[model samples]
Target: MPRIKSPALLVAESGADREGHGLRRSMGLFQLICFGVGAIVGTGIFVGLSDSVAQAGPAVVVSFVLAAITCVFTAFAFAELGGAIPVSGSSYSFAYAGLGETTAFLVGWCLLLEYGVSVSAVAVGWSQYVNELLDSLLGVQLPAALSASPGDGGAVNLPAVLVIAMAAALLVRGVRESARATAAMAVLKLAILVAFCAIGLSAFRDGNLMPFAPAGIAGIGAGTTAAFFSYIGFDAITTAGEEARNPRRDIPVAILVCIGVVTVLYCAVALAAIGAIGGDAVGGQPAALSYVVDEVTGSGVGGGIVAFGAVVAIASVVLAVMYGQSRILMSMSRDGLIPGVFEKVSPRTATPVAGTLIIAVVFAVPAAFSSLDAVVNLCTIGTLAVMAAVNVAVIALRRREPELPRTFRVPLYPVLPLLGVGCCLYLMYETGWTTWLQFAAFLAAGLLVYLGYGRRRSRLARVTPDADATDAVPQPV
Candidate 1:
């Protein structure tokens, strides 16, 4: 039997009518915004907040703002590329079009770690919250063997695995269905967060903020780096460029609006959490939100609600991240940078079913057994690297293709992109050397894939898109 090659290596003109690629152009600005929100407001807010507050005390609120500013810089660059290219691959396609094959492969490589592992990490976090909610609401709980990962002294996380599998099923069914599910969950999560803020604020103590810079400026910087992970999903808006109804106008709007919404939410949530619990308690205490709520409300109800909200929120994150990974794989497959099978679309559902399933399996395993913090750190590094690359791509495209039609352009050319690169690099450094080592290992794997298959097979390696060509119309649904 002949070995079946991966679909990611197939080179073909991508369009809605293409046999293997079935992503539809049915998403509009609202759906796009929902995607961003679903992806952005997950484990970072629910789980990572405790760590950030611990690192920076009440000053984590300021860290959230700083992280948002960093994201804004890259968001501008992404909006420009996403609008101009309007493709399914997100940063991967943009880098291919503007940079080159090697760089494109690297971008895809970075995204694999960023989205794949991030989904796993979010699923793991979801498991904890689900267990918390069950214990609180039903007076029952998943056994330790089923609720925690192996490293965390458990056999497997059944809840995490279940969530990943369910999300995969939804994605394999169709993008629209998945988006609807995500949007519903996002709404619930936001509502719960707002409720927490309103209630928690009533219990705020000014003294909780006395040692605002407990970790000092260094701690604040570290907090910002950690908090930056919370902002990763803001770029999910750009991932839907090809699906978006009006990429040029809506992608930018969605990105900006999502960032603004999430930033404000992060600040409010941090302020409330810190004010109610104090920075020391939030940082040192596990399941800080629940503890804070129990302390203030004089009942378990607040904690139960937040835990339930977290479960729902991280479910959406897992779905969105997996969705993004599959799409990127589809794009790579179409470009002949990976095996052709990954590009195969389900005739009935019109989705990259093979790719989606493959990634689902990959993510599910880790989600079942890995630690959330380890996965989160890994994702943060990959995301920061990609953001930095996008910043450079922005400058490169501007200088290289001065005449290309752009629906959205990053203002303050060079300056904003440069700042974006600088900020991402600073965060990358703050991610610590251990995470960097893991990132380096991931990058090495990507290099092996590129050298082994991607370099020789890449469509761009054979025929680069003409710099002046305007004939490549956006794919229709």
Candidate 2:
């Protein structure tokens, strides 16, 4: 029989307080919400809005709503599972408890694509805004060779790699400091976006919204596909399962609150940008938020402010997402799925120091050379796959451990979970054919690694009654 970890054991481990054995529980409800908001509002809002606008025109607002339906359905499942499991492994832990070991490994492998590549991609986006900010302020910016990726007509992207390294340094310093920075940056980001909307609406021309669907339903569908990935950020909150104070309560509420906050920001920003400058100008513009601000004010002051905001905002995404990625690997390491180095938490900092540096170097190299639009679809495909597994795990756990202590439950029972899975599949189908092939290669690579390394080394390989003994975990108050 395949090994399925017990949810009871998972919860027991999360609540354990052995010296130097677990992550520091420093985040509360507020920080968790800020982390989610910080992660979601980055590259997707600051950079990709133009491409989405080009696709859906003024109708991009509709696309945001359509895309949010997927997140709405998935959030309920995540909230429920996050409350019940509350492990640093996030969905991977949920799967390990609800599904078999092989399946859990696959879910984790897919997450590398989600959190890992997404941060690199966000870093690349940050480079564009960095130049915008510098040029607006000092009339100078880094050259293409230093700022642009090789695929984008440059030799290497130094800025991208540097940003990732900086984020790693902050993560290594400690999660508490990282959360504090994220919360502050989250407030700054919201303020800039709200300011952009207000300024843009002041210059709003009703005629700019003419021909709302230039590309028709097909265009709207394409835009919806682009917008859907923006919602992937909230799951970063789930990865904090080990570091959250009163996680069972805070984690679930954080997911819900993050989604609500992000959805409003996305729709409002998209609408405001399109309203001020018209879809034609907004479409295909890099440094779009800055561009929109410049057009409205006819001065660099507003543009510079928005650019500065984008710089800080995107860095926070890099910080929060990289933190989540490091934690995931650390959890996998504890299970003997990856190198033991990942499991080594520094007693001084209470953070996975070595694992974080490795992640930074591995991801930053690709950030120096990879194309922006190329791997985004790869990240989306990977994220959708993991979410589908999470929805399934929720159902599996309910049937297998009906009495498990859960602070929250998915309404409509299995129907909501099933819809969540369906939404994931539908969105996955929207990506290009290359994304499917790439995901297949990643899946196969994961299987080989598991069979050759993880399976033999996994702590569960020799599970015994005494080894697994732990008292039932009580639901958080």
TM-score of 2: 0.96
lDDT of each: 0.80, 0.86
TM-score of each: 0.93, 0.96
Model 1 over residues 241-266: C-alpha lDDT tens digits?
55666776888888888898999999
* Strongest candidate by TM-score: 2
- Any runs in candidate 2 off by more than 4 Å, and if so which? 14-20, 464-477
What digit string (tens of lDDT, one per residue) describes model 2 on residues 1-477? 667778777766544323345588899999999999988888888888998998999999988998887887888888998888788888788888777788999999999999888888899999999999999999999999888877799989988999899999999999999999999999999999999989988988888998999999989988998987777678889889888888889988999998888888889888789889899999999889899999899999899999999999899999989988888888788888888999888989999999999999999988999875777888898899888898998898899788878899999999988998998888788887888998899899999999999988887765642232222344333
**CA RMSD, predictions in order:** 4.5, 2.3
